[model samples]
Target: MSHEIEIHADGTAAFVSANTPGWHRLGVVAPGPMTVPEALKLGQLADWNVRMEPLVAAVAGSKCLECSKPLGDKHDDMCVTGDHEGQDDSRIVDEHDTTHAVEVPNNRAVVRTHPVTGLPEVLSVGGLDYTPISNEEMGQTLQAILDQSGAIVDTAGSLRGGLDTFITARLPKGIMVGGADPVELNLAGFNYFRPGKSSEFLITPVRVVCANTQAAALYNFRSRYTVRHSPNAPQRIIEAREALKITFDYRDAFADEAEKMIKAELTIKEFERLCREIWPAPDPEANSAVKDRDDALTGTLMQIFKGETNENIKGKKTRGTHWSGYQTVVEYLDHHAPVRGEDADSGRIRAERALVGKARDTKELAFNLFQVA
Candidate 1:
């Protein structure tokens, strides 16, 4: 069996091995735990375009369209140098207002196929966000804050938290869509939880390939904490992640009938195993399992929650969902999008390291991976 194994930055591996001769392909396993978003992205890109660059999406414009500067660097602080590569928010000084236009370059990275395999190698020439943090600084508490509060936390089984929890809080208080307020957004404590008010709990935090919401949060929370929990603990993050994973699997496994080759008979046992692997059975008899919570907002978080849907994403129309508590948090962070301003020919803005509550005004919603042909 000919196989190609690729190691992702998150310590996960993608092994493409052949089965039943070269024609039949089998097994797309994610051995290690990564973020839920990472897994979902990988799964989607599996058969989609091999030419998209997710790493580039990771950073807004790692590569400069004007001077061809390599855009992405480590997460802390990346720069295009050489006059910002005409990158956005760049300016050209004029002695007498003589049209000193330093073309606000379209921070878009180039997508190219792998040179050797003839496959794609979505290279993100310059999608580096913020600045680089020194080992010393990373050990500080603020960095911990950044990690915990991403835009929309990942949901893969690998971790406890997703970006959704921390995206908005990572930035200054005043930033957001339609200029909403953070406290009004009311995203303080845990979701679907009151923490400490519940039962005795324990969870081993793992930044897995498929993370649940709590896992997503723990991934960030660990930065601030000392001794971490065990993998054996009842992790709500895992519970949420698995639930969503099952949904994704169900959706894709049944995407289209005529599209693919056969491997047709998916057994009940196999389906059950997938489910078990994805989520923990919620005391199955617990009535609270299916009930959605009411998220009426009166606190600081509520105001922002009310604003998340002023714009739309993939046509989901998040603003209209009126999911209450769940949505209120989204509104708080929507204001912090890394925007440049109007007059920008390219409707592009660098994605912030924090959670992305809303990307309505930006050019395109970024994909998590790069497609290298």
Candidate 2:
């Protein structure tokens, strides 16, 4: 598949083109297992473990757990039955709707407190814009959907929530778990098993990377062995202090190489064409970043920084609020104090250092084996 990524000479990341054609993507958002929260933040943040396609599934069901819904699956992954064709399932059921088991919409949405960050965020599930409200409020009129997805990673030590580690296992499509009930797994166990404090569900989310292939397999192996991230002071920064400090579902190495491959694969002209497609402008690729007026899209990245001066960039011109969104990230890393461990670089992160961490951690920490595959 075609892709677009930017890598620096130092093997660091620049950015991965989310608009590349023929590129399969697995978006591993870094906020909450709650789809709504992650999606909301995705529309705001940067330096996340971006992929070509969503690979994980939000686990559901209780007891001898059965397969349920999946957040990221190919269109043909599964199918559901409905009443008459072209009619809403409810209408058929209403023969007072003889209808039953209708196909659900894909673009799901939601916003909720994360297991760790606790910061409220928007999540993207099945389709993209799923609502966080219970299906009962909309579906069962009293039912709710509580699901989360990602690879299973063990906890570092322990914590509250009776969950120290957890996994985001996938269930059969449409299946769900409503409240705090227990579920069991066969060989793999539930995708997300919040066992108890100190050991619970953890997701090693692999993005657009195809797990069926050798590359993805190698990636998972590395995740099992890599040293975990250690957070310093300022624990109150956000609920994600511990959550974001994790290293799983290795996309670090793949993201790194992919970024370089994307840049090298595209010439300056190709890059321009892609920008136009994904983020088009009237005069794309003009000699100067700005054409005639001082619109956000036209202005130079430098000009935006100069005018905004590290202020938040609204999505209006920057698209995805690139300016201010990126600025927020820069500020986030800027406030990150030095590390006290032997694993990560023992330095404070800043504008450049933040991205440096991003590059190193994306696929490296996610899946890269100390020994090359």
Q: Which candidate is the best by TM-score?
A: 2
Query: What lDDT tens digits, residue by residue, belong to model 1 across residues 237-306?
Result: 3343233223322212211211121112323343233323322344546566332111221223435534
Report lDDT (CA) for all predictions. Answer: 0.25, 0.26
lDDT of 2 by residue, 1-373 (tens): 1112222234332211122211223223333222323322332222222111232434332211112222232112223322237864331112121212333444332233342344543333333321122211111110111222232211111111211111222222111111111112100111111211111112222211121111122333422221111122122222222332343223344344333332232233433333344234656667553555324442343343344443322222322222232222232224332344443333322222322234224223222222222
Candidate 2 — worst ten consecutive residues by lDDT sum? 186-195
What would the TM-scores of all predictions be?
A: 0.16, 0.18
Estimate the TM-score for candidate 2: 0.18
Q: Which portions of model 1 show Cα errors greater than 4 Å?
A: 1-216, 219-302, 306-326, 335-338, 341-347, 350-373
Candidate 2 local distance difference test against the native? 0.26
